[model samples]
Target: MSDATLMLSGIEKSYNRGTPGEVSVLRGVDLSVQRGEVVALVAPSGAGKSTLLHIAGLLDVADTGRVEIAGQDLTDLSDTRRTATRRADVGFIYQFHHLLPEFSALENIVLPQLAHGVPRAQAQTRAQDLLDRVGIAARADHRPAALSGGEQQRVAFCRALANEPKLLLADEPTGNLDPETSDQVFAALMDLVRGTGLSALIATHNMELAARMDRQIRLEAGQLIPLGGAQRPA
Candidate 1:
């Protein structure tokens, strides 16, 4: 086992295999994200960003190659075992909040922890603390319908972190927000992630946000390209 928080090597994925309409999303893609390191994955809308993210998060599998998180190789795990590993080691966020319509903000955050075997009292405490960190403790009792876009995304962030996963994978988390709200929400997310020392691989079309990450990589023609020479803000 290695120390990387997330690693993918020689990954390949295609749809409608052995057919005339087959589409290849990932081809021999390889990347590694270290513990406490944040990496930005930049690509166009039709690129394979989401495909790569799903594979990394274990929400989906690659046709071939390795998927490892916290030094554990998951490519060969049974579906049940892979799901267990995902719940234990990976946290995911998406463009939509996806909060339960009937649950209060705090409850939405607490549920995942509870499922992961956290005590109810402890989960509630952690949920409140997470809301406070995002400056939304006052909104913790409100349901998603009552909160604004930014607030709902913040709650989603809290829910994703509730299980205390080692790695966080986000796909355009702020893509649904207006520019101003997106900036605020992204800042809140960064602060929370840094405070917890969690590794992250975030996919985004927003170059400004990508530049803020510790490292940046791009997907082109089904391959990962390091952008070490790219200029980023000082």
Candidate 2:
């Protein structure tokens, strides 16, 4: 595969394949997302963008082929081992803010670090710094219930970043906000990740955003291909 922070080779996935209800989500898809690179995935609904993100993040296993994270093949690992690998290496961002409603912004970001056994003092410091960078330090004490949609998403970005992951997976991160708020949140998210040497694969329907990233790929009929296919360039 290409020199990448993440790789999925010859992957095939389907469900209920023996009957008329059968559906194939990905077919022999091969992809390589290199380190420190940001790639956008743009596709129509039902094209399996989310499915491909899930498989790449190790949240769900592929039915065939190999998945590699920083050169370690995970297709052979058990569920428990896979979970451990993901916790340490990958970060996820979703369209909706998945922050814990009961926890304050700072607490929400720190909780994952605590789960991984990081020192409470260090976790707090890092979480605070992340919040500040995301422009949410002022809202650090507020719970999700008290925050606006954009504010909450900003907090989620901090939470996703607290671990300093090798690769990031985002699914329509700005999908729920208005144009202005979405731009603000997206700016903060990119700024927080700037100079971090992190790799990212983001699924988006926004053509402008797709064009801004290092590369763009499309999902169609369960296959992954370059944007505009072979007509674009050599």
lDDT (tens digit, per residue) of candidate 1 on 147-220: 99999999999999999999999999999999999999999999999989999999988988888888989998
User: What is the Å distance of residue 36 in model 2 from its true position?
Assistant: 0.3
Against the true structure, candidate 1 reaches a TM-score of: 0.96
Those runs of model 1 whose alpha carbons end farther than 4 Å from true positions after fitting are 229-234
Q: For each candidate in the order shown, give its overall lDDT on alpha carbons.
A: 0.92, 0.87
lDDT of 1 at 146: 100
> Which portions of model 2 show Cα errors greater than 4 Å?
228-234
Cα error, residue 121 of model 1, in Å, equals: 0.3
User: Among all windows of ten consecutive residues in candidate 1, which has the lowest summed lDDT?
Assistant: 225-234
Model 2: per-residue lDDT, tens digit, 3-110? Answer: 689988999999887889989999999999887778889889888889899999998878899999999888989889989888899999999988999899999999
